[model samples]
Target: DAYGAIRANQGLYLSSWGQLGASGDQLDLTPARQQLDSAYHLSDSLSQSAQDHNADALDSRQNLKQAGDDADDRYGNSEQLSDADQSNARGATDSGGRGEAARMKAPWLHLASPAGITLSTPESTHLAQGRSLSISSGEDVNIATGKSLVASISEKLSLFVQKAGIKLFAARGKVEMQAQDGEMAFTAEKGVKVTSTEGRIEINAENGILLQSGGGYIRIEGGNIEVHCPGAADLKGAQHNFGGPTSLTRTQPEL
Candidate 1:
């Protein structure tokens, strides 16, 4: 009954009032409204999804840049440490070699060799051998041998010869000789003589000095002072002074 009433009303109103409306095309608007609503909803959803994807891509790029910066800092620190270690190792090796050379050149130790020995030193040296001996030094020298000996010195040397004999090859300094129970001979550029001894002493010098012989006679041909005695006598020779008393005098020379 309600549907029949609405249809009868719609037909009466449309016949009277519908003629008063504008036109047929203006009145038909249902299809256009449905199409416009569908297009607007689809466009809004697509725009929202695109914005979320762009935000995720930006976050990923920032993370990668931060990781690259951290790795570079670690590499720079490692290189500095490696260079420091190498420099320390080289310095230790050079210092050790210099220490060894210093110990070898000390003057305290006594050096000896056969077939005539050659020596250089800043201090004194002592040589004792039965064969012919030769010595050289910057300081003093003392030679006591059973046979002939030759000595050279840049400084002062105190020489003692046994019953055999001695020949002073060269001397740049003073020479003092003691021939005990033996005959000793020496030559010098400056001065040479004998002090006190039980044997005979012969000295030849250019500068000239005092020479004396005790139980043994000290003979100096061209020295400053020359003396000959039977017992032990004080002999001042070159740059040396001798002192002592004489013993028994023997007619036959000991050496």
Candidate 2:
């Protein structure tokens, strides 16, 4: 009768007989339902290992708050590139101190100084003819007579014209005269005439020329004469105006 109650409970019905009592009564209920199904599968494997340790501690606190917000956005972009390199080095030192104070307050029209040629005092004086004047000096240039010296020197001018009456006219221009060095006799007190049409004249003197002429073939004409004497060439009507080697005395023809 169910193997006679598993053979009268062979010590809780394992088996004494009953023909091994229904296979030891189903192996005695399989170890008490396998210890209640291994304590309900060890409480569902400790509740899935406590929900995977609370999802790995919330993914390790969101990866430590995204690594502290990427180190505070790289320390605020390095303090805005260190305040834009100190505002471009203080605006290039305030634009080079306002360009050296506008080049020391500007003003110097024209001046050449070593102790000479610095002229700018035009208030009004008069010497207006063709109007052009220039002066150059390395040394010694004195022209003093109410100062109205005009010039058009194409070349060659050696000066020592004192007594102040310089009206140097050279419509064709050629002059070379020298006298003024210890002064044996230098007189142009108001007279030194030099006129030129075709321009050809030469007068080198230790003292001579009290009126002469030219244009009569040998009467002293048309330019070109040479005279150098150590003693005498005093002519009245002339013998070819006493040619060179110096010797002629015939004075007495001027009243």
Q: Report model 2's TM-score to 2 decimal places.
A: 0.17
lDDT of each: 0.35, 0.34
Native-vs-model 1 lDDT? Answer: 0.35
**Alpha carbon deviation, residue 169, candidate 1 (Å):** 99
Tens digit of lDDT per residue, candidate 2, span 128-150?
53533323232356757585568
Taking the tens digit of each residue's C-alpha lDDT, what string does model 1 give over 1-255?
Answer: 455433221111111223224433221222322333343343344335545544111223333232223222110111223223322222223343111111111111222222333567877677775533332232345867675567576534433332345665444544545654545654566766556555666533333445343455445334223555665556476787567743332253333
Model 1: weakest 10-residue lDDT segment is 97-106
Q: What is the lDDT of candidate 2?
A: 0.34
Clashes of 2: 3
